[model samples]
Target: MKFLAITLIVHTPHPATGVVQSTTERFREVLDNAVLAEELGFDGFGVGERHEWPFLSSAPPVVLSHIAALTSRIRLFTAVTTLSLLDPVRAYEDYATLDHLSGGRLELIIGKGNGAAQRELFRVTPEDQWARNAESYEVFRRIWREDKVSAVTRFRPGLKDAEVWPRPLQRPVRVWHGSATSKESVELAARYGDPLFSANVTHPIEPYAELIRHYRERWRHYGHDPARITVGAGTAGVYVARTSQEAVAAYRPVFEGNLALQKSLGLEPVFTTLDDFVERSSALVGSPQQVIDKVHRYHEQFGHTVLHLHADAGGLTRTRHHDSLTLFQSEVAPVLRRDIPDPPFPWGPVLHAPAPAATPLAR
Candidate 1:
């Protein structure tokens, strides 16, 4: 299985203390984490987009552009770009530019964003988000794949015989629909035959598994080859250690604290305890064997080819975060790649060596 390290730059102050890192420091930490992810042999590094307090990832393209200049090999991805809230023309321009700067290492996962704050920021209502998202994505796809496009849409301005400049470096940039609760996203992905990446962060695996099944069914319904369909899944958390007991003991405090915050915010408390999270939710916190088994179980359920994990949450220390990434990369990741089925997407595009000038790490 291809592994991606998703960086959700969250802010809830330090768990040990009520103090919060400065905004500048927080941004630096995120950049540092991306650089470290590349050094650790992570297949992909993804950043999320959120326009709200307690999250620092509103400008995914800009951040990813900086990362692209810094790193040479690791693929850069957006966990979910809020397609519902942006002008497709501008989004296309920014991402296409980024694709060029990254030497064609950019991938996108589009979604109808959640959170009331985002809707307020974009002046979009919940009722119109799905429609807007569909319309925006349709325009965005055409803008990327087609040379000249003319479209009249609600959210996007009309283009009359005008061509978007600096077309993406890739012929057609790869896009994966970020499916969580919306069947619209699933159906849209199916109709277009694009890959679907399930947001398996909040709830248990059953709902997400069902959504994946529906995606594949609809993919086949659209006369697309089922074998051509690709699926990527996110996990609630991942922290590997030498033993399950130690993993639980170390991760329990962070898990419990995160749960408390969720409850306070009136969000659904899916898995209330660490044990419950490990047993039911997709949080893979345990020993190497235990982590391997959890992933195998998820593969059996959803048949995911790309697996993204969040190893740092609730403000875990840098040391702990590095340790988790090291253990997983050294022990668990290799096991999954050996045992899991080959990913539907060609690894050549992602894993291919870059040109000498594009490869800056040697410098």
Candidate 2:
């Protein structure tokens, strides 16, 4: 099994204490955590993209490029680059450059994205988002796989044998489609034989499990080999301790603070209480063994070889949060490693140097 420490770089006053760090401090915190994620032996570290308030992750490529300089082995990921709001050509240029700068250690997860403010800012309506995302991905994929691409695109200007600069370091980087209860995303991923990463954070396991099932079903329908299907999943949060009581007790305040923040933002809280969140949602708040058991239960349905835990402390003190992650690395990961099968492909990039000029990616 592979694990990632991912952050959306949420920038807000402390939910518990109402204390806020300056923008510089928040960015440094993300960089420091990326380095620590490498030291803690996580397989990957992901930075998310958002164009809304309370989130400082609008430029994932810039953040990841800095992280690339700070760490050597940990693969850098765009937790879910919101392609619907971006120009595919520009996005490709940025990430391809990042791939080279990172020594070919880059992976991407693309999504339609959420948030009303961002949708308005991009002028991408809910009805238009999925189509825009699909269109953008089609263009982005072609630019990555071909030296010169020609396409009549709707959202973006048409391309006519356009040559995108500085071909990526990876012969072909792995791209995961981020699906949050969207059949369009599942079908798109299946049609292209790419992996699917489920946003398993919002609701109960059943909805997410059903989405995975749909993805596999469509994978087969698309005539892709079932044996080659790969999947990854996300958790809402994680905080492990020596005992379940201690774990829950410590996380309860954090949960309450988040709930309060949600209400203040005029968003409905999914799991009204901490107990419900732990029991129903994908949040892992328990002893190491208990967390292991919960993951196993999800794996039974998800068959996901990769999983991600939140990198931020949320409202918990930095010391407490780091200790919890340390415990996870020490006691939980090894057991899961022995139990779950590894991902079908290597987590890192395949090649480290420039591809042949004008060469299209090979299957």
Candidate 3:
């Protein structure tokens, strides 16, 4: 299985101590974390995009470009680029440039982002959000694949033989659709034969498992080979220790703080306690063996080939956070890699052969 360390760049104060860092320090923390993920041999390092308060990830391309300059091998990902709120032309240009800057190490996970604040900022109605997302992706896909494209859409002005420059280094850049309780996203992914990444952060596994089942069913319905279907899953959080008791104790404060924050934001508290979170949610707080067992259990349900653990430490100390990841790499990843197989496609952009050049449209 491929392992990715991902962060939303949340700017909340320390849950227990009420301490916060300067914006500069927080940004540095994210960059340093990306470097560390590369140093520790993670397959990918992802930066999320959120335009609302408590999240500093509004500019993913900017952040990922800096990460690209610092790391050599670790693939950089937009945890979920808010395509619904962006112009596909601009989004395509930015990521396409990033693809070249990173030597084709860029992979995108696109979605209709959540948050009322951002939807209002972008002037997108709730009724039109899914439609906007689908249209944006359709435009974005063509922008990456074809040159001098002409298209008309309700969301943006018509493009007549427009050339989006610095085309993607990847022949057809790999895009994974981010799905959370949305059939539109799943069906869109199936229609295009792209992979699906489950935003399995909140609630129990059944809802997410059902979504994956739907994705697979639609993939078969679309006449795509079952063997070509790839799925990725996200965890609630992760903190591994030598024993389950030790892991729980270490992560208790973090979980409690998060639970309180969720209530403050008017979000429903899915798991009341840390024990419940570990039992129900995708949080991987346990001994190495226990963590492995939980992953295996979920694998049986989701058949996921890629797994992402929270890169943000939450309320844990930096030292403890570093140690947890170290332990995960040393203990957890090897066992899982032995048991799980990777997706059929290459993890990063395929760069050995030159992609076909785009032909100009006839006037």
Candidate 4:
């Protein structure tokens, strides 16, 4: 299995302390984490796009460009580029430029983004967002696969033999549809035979699992090779310690504090307590073995070959944060890599050589 460390660059105050980092400091922290993820041998690092308060990840291409300069090997990803809010041609040009800068190591996970703020900021309504997402993706993919394109689009101006400059370096970059609580994204992925990445952080496994099943069914309907379908999943959070007790003790407050944040946002949370969150939600907070077991349980449902963990420190102290992730890399990650079958998307146009899972000291 391939592992990725991704952050939305949330700029919220510390859940427990109410302390917020300056925007500059927070951005630097993101850059530093990208470097650390590469150093720790993560397969990829992803920056998310969120155009709302308490989220500084409004421009993923700019963030990923800086990350490309810092890491030589780890692939770069957009957690879920808000294609619904972007002009497909402009988006294509930006990512195509990034592909060259990253030496053909850029992959995208596209979606119709969520949030009331998206409507306010981008003037895209929920009623129309999915349609915009689908149309934009169609044009975006065409830009990558074809030299010039002519098409009529409702959301954007018509294109006629338009050549998007600085053609992509990857022959064609890989795109993974980001599915959350919808069949539209799944259907789109299946229609194109592209991979699907589940935003599995919210709610329970059943909803996301149902989406994957739909994806597989549609893939067969579309006459794509079943063996070529790829899926990636995200955990709500991850923290490991020597024992479950220690891990729970460390993460409980963070969980409760975030639950409070959820209430403050006026959205009812599905997992109300730490126990429930650990038991049902996709958070991986426990001893190394317990975390591994939970992943296996999720795998039984998700069949995900790529797994992403929260990249930020969240509410943990720097020491605990670094140690927990390092321990996971040294202990938990190798086991999954050994046991899980490899998915096809990781082998891009320019295949990267596998690196040691972790440094000798970490092992």
Candidate 5:
């Protein structure tokens, strides 16, 4: 299975200490984490895009450009570009530039991002969000694939034989639709033959599994090859330790604090306790063996070959966080790599080797 490290670049105070890093510090930490992810052998590094408070990831193209400059070989991804709130023409221009800057290692995961405040900021009503997402994505895809395009879009100004410049380095950049609760996103992805990435962080695996099943059914309905269907899943969080008991004990404080914050914010609780959260939700807080077992269990239902682990340190100390990642790379990934099959298409940047020269005719 392919592994990715993703962050939302949330600027909340440390859960336990209540000390918040300055915005500059937080961004630097994100860049440092990207470097660390590459050093630790993650296949891709993702930066999320959010336009509201507590999230400083509003400009993913700028952040990813810096990351691209600092690293090579590791694929750069937008965890979920809020397509519903963007102008497709401008979004296309930025990502096209990013694709070139990253040496064609750009992949996009688009979604109708959640958050009432953000929706208000973008002047998008709940009723029209899904339609806007679908329309924006349609335009975005065409802009990438075609040279000149003309379209009448509801959300943006009509394009009349408009030609977007500096086409993407990849002939057609790969896009994964991010599906949380909506079949709209799933159906859209299926209709276009794009991949799906489940935002599996909030609830139990069953709901996400259902979405994947729907995606597969719709993919087949849309006349796409079943064998080529690709799915990726995200986790709530991860903190690995030498033993399951030790890991749970270490992560308990972080979980309790975060849950309390959630309650204060009027968010309905999903899992009442840490143990329940670990068991039910996608959070992987345990020994290497337990984490591995959890992933395998989800894989049985989701049949996903790509998995992204939450890279936010949360309440753990930097030392503990780094150690946990180190343990995962050293212990868990190798086992899962052997057990799970890879996706049919290349999961990372496609490196082409020189073709063999024609040989003399049996001289």
Candidate 6:
């Protein structure tokens, strides 16, 4: 399976130091982390977009463009770009440029954002989010595929036989629709013959697994090859260690902080206890064997080719975060690489680049 390191530059206080990174430090860390993912043998790197208090990743295209300049081999992705609130023409132009800048190593995953604050900023109603998301994607797809495009969408510019500049490096850049709790997104993905990526961070496996089932069935209904259908899944958190006990003890405070944040948002918490957190949720906190077992179980449910692990500092110290990732790379990854099935696509070859500890990323 193809593995990716996904992050949202959330600016919260560090648990150990009780000090928050300055805007400068946060941005630098993001770039450093992306470069680190490349050096660590990660297949892909994704940055999430959220125009809210904690998240500093409102501009995915700009950040990705910079990553393109710094790194050579790792594919860059927008973990979830809020397409419903964007102007499709502008979004197409921006990403198309990034595709060239990155040497065609760009993948996009679009979604209707979760935050109400962001929806309000774009004057989008909760009820209209699905409609706008579908419409925006339609326009975006057309602009990317057609040289001279003409469209009159409600939320986008009415093109009068206009052509977008700097056509993408890839003839048609691959897109993955990101779905959390929406059937609309799933159907949209199936209808377009694009892949579906489940936002499995918020809930249990059953719901997301069912969504993938629906996507596959719809793919058949749409007369697309069922075998060609691709699915990508997200994990809640990750931390590998020498022993299960050590892993749990070290990650408990950060886990509690994550739960507290979810509670403050008034959303239902998925995993209530630490034991259930490790068992049910996608949080991979355990020894190498334990982590491998969990991943195999998830593959049984979703049959996904791509898996993304979120390793946010999440109130943990920077040192702890790096330790967890290093241990995971050294111990867990090699075992899974041999045991799990490879991703269906011929992704050419694994790429690596020099680490850039200096480049600053927007939080």
* Best model per TM-score: 3
Identify the superior model by TM-score, candidate 1 or candidate 6: 1
Candidate 6 regions exceeding 4 Å error are: 348-363
Residue 165 lDDT in candidate 3: 89
Better of 2 and 4 by lDDT: 2
Deviation of model 1 at 39, angstroms: 1.3
Estimate, for each residue in 122-172, the C-alpha lDDT of model 3 and write its tens digit: 999899999889888888888888776777788888778899988778878
- Candidate 5 Cα errors over 4 Å, as ranges: 349-363
- Candidate 4 TM-score over all chains jointly: 0.95
lDDT tens per residue, model 1, 1-363: 888888768877776666788988877877887888889888889999999876888999999999998899888999899999988889999999999899888999999988998899889998899999988888888777666676677665576656897877876778999999769999999998899999988887888999999998999899998788899999888777899998887787678778867876788887766788888888888999999999999899889889998735454667877898899899998989999876776753443322222111111
Task: Give candidate 3's error at residue 9 in angstroms.
Answer: 0.5
What TM-score against the true fold does each predicted structure earn?
A: 0.94, 0.96, 0.96, 0.95, 0.95, 0.92
Q: What local lDDT does model 4 show for residue 129?
A: 95
Report, for every candidate in turn, its global Cα lDDT versus the true structure: 0.84, 0.91, 0.91, 0.88, 0.89, 0.83
The superposed Cα distance between candidate 2 and the true structure at residue 264, in angstroms, equals 2.0
Q: Model 4, range 31-147, lDDT digits (tens) per residue?
A: 998998889889999999999876899999999999999989999999899999999999999999999999888999999998998677989998999999988988887777767
Which regions in candidate 4 have their CA more than 4 angstroms from the true location? Answer: 350-363
For model 6, what is the alpha-carbon lDDT of residue 35?
Answer: 87
> In candidate 2, what are the lDDT values of residues 1-363, reduced to their tens digit?
999999999987887788999999999999999998999999999999999988999999999999999999999999899999999999999999999999999999999998999999989999989989988988888788778787887887888889998888887788999999879999989988999999998889999999999999999999998888999999999999999999999898789888887887798988998889999999999999999999999999999999999999988889989999999999999999999988888776777433433312222
Per-residue lDDT value at 98 in model 2: 98
lDDT tens digits by residue: candidate 6, 47-69: 99898877899998998888888
Error of 1 at 215 (Å): 0.6
User: Comparing candidate 1 with candidate 4, which one achieves the higher TM-score?
Assistant: 4
Model 2 score (lDDT): 0.91
